[model samples]
Target: MDVRLLEKEGFAGLFMRLRAEGLADKPLLAALEQTPRTLFVSAAHADAAYQDRLLPIDCGGFAESADLVARLLSLLSLEPGQRFLDVGTGSGFLAAVAARMVERVVTVDRYKTLVQLAQQRFAHLGIGNVIARQADGLKGMSGEGAFDRIIATCAFDSMPRAFVEQLASGGVMLAPILAEDGRARMARLTKIGSRFEREDLFEVPYRPFIPGLAAAL
Candidate 1:
């Protein structure tokens, strides 16, 4: 068997499945194949790294599946020379995958443990463009300048007004929003001048966004 083909067999299978379901795009597939998801997978659940399943990480959080990550990223339509903000660094798998496609990435997580672990992964993998820090993502981090694209890994009710306002004009944000009716769905908000165009996408099973930073854990 060809070694290159063997390396892609993992997400490569997922890439084809997502493509058939209209979820995968070519560039994202390439990026996924290049990124080592195993490095970010929690040791206890490393088996799910490239298996199209959410991996259980530390601090009771979950790392989204490669397919879900690719689907959300495709919605962002990321471009070169773009500064992206990732809310909820988690295991930093998504941020690592994204770093290859953008100019820079600022990813924030509430848990200090997650932040420290993720930073170590980024350094081990030689991923320098991502800035992983512990912060309150609900309010958005300040002094980072404007972002061309942003993505939240968790679910929220209503909109993240602070993050919406921080986007550069014409910037795009991808997040999962929950409604009062108990229905939750993914949404893409594109900022055009002073207003935002909200487009709700598929239903998702993401953890609700928590406010404030983790005092411990």
Candidate 2:
């Protein structure tokens, strides 16, 4: 990948677009500048790498929605050296970007083939701080609620109870929350004591949350 191309052209355009959309952020723009989105998926879609469009990947999944991905990452408000849990970790595109800013990323997907392919991509990229696993997204990652951040690429009819339970206090859960009318709304929820404060960020269209996944949320 031509790393300079992102800084020289891709990110420049991304910044302008984000600013016009009222979505600009320094950290996310930096991430967009540093991470080569083309490296995350098949060569067939390479031409569309920085076009701000979602592309198809394995397991009938679409790489994180382009604008949504950027905005979602920004909303997570990730800091350097933090740990992030990525549920529905698709092509590892978001995880790859996360690895650049965070200390480590624990990403899980329910699809075995996707996990294998994503792991291969991670290895090819020489990324060592990410653990990509094929596990039920609703089950949530175990261990002491130690993550500093958590985000799900998929959208759920309701917030997953497991995600809320596993979230560390003061940590945020970024997800697409499906409204009663079935429209997806981008949101960020912060765990506070035993309760969570959900904030709707924007409207979005996403692949539905996994089957039975909403029931548990």
Candidate 3:
């Protein structure tokens, strides 16, 4: 798909809608404008890349919509020179976006193929600040230590302690937490010294958070 056409006909409307809903800002919109969603998905889905919906990707994973990603990034309050951790990297879309806003991004996925694809995507985009790895996201990347911001693209029954521990003081994390009523709610956690304050952002549907590393390609 042509980049100009995608921006003019697709992303422009999406951004306008996000602005109307108070889910977008100047920096976030600029980052989304710079990153083409088409480059992150397979060619078959390229036409739908800019649409405000999730697109299925490899390993039964789904690329989140631009709106959701924008909202998550806005909530994270990312700043330049901050470190970021992206769980369930999927197509590396979120990581790529975060990399543009932060100094470094460490993105983890359980599927090897997904990680490989994410790495390739990062390279193709000339994104040097993102480190894509294949590992159990539930375990988190301890080696990376604390991060200024963390975001999970998948839904989990509960927030993992590892993720909480990896957040630097005053850091923020956004994830989809499954509630007792069988609904997933977008939750935000902020690490304040030794305590983590939780806030429910909104209700949204997302793929379940799978634990452990995948054995298959």
Worst ten in a row by lDDT for model 2: 208-217
| TM-score for each model | 0.92, 0.86, 0.94
Lowest summed lDDT across 10 adjacent residues in model 3 is found at 1-10
Residues 50-139, model 1: lDDT tens digits: 677667889998888888888888888877799999999998988998898999999999999999999999999798999998998887
TM-score of 1: 0.92
Model 3 Cα lDDT, one tens digit per residue, 80-182: 9999999888888888988999999999999999999989888888999999888888767897778999888778888655677788889988878889887
The lDDT values for all models are 0.83, 0.77, 0.84
Q: What does the lDDT read for residue 146 in candidate 1?
A: 91
Clashing pairs in model 1, backbone N/Cα/C closer than 3 A: none
lDDT of 2 by residue, 38-134 (tens): 6776778766666777788876778854556777888888888888999887878888878878888999888878887888888887889999887
Top candidate on TM-score is 3
Index of the highest-lDDT prediction:
3
Task: Report RMSD (Å) for each prediction in the order shown.
Answer: 2.5, 3.9, 1.5
Over 4 Å off, model 1: 1-7
- Clashing residue pairs in candidate 2 are 160-217, 161-217
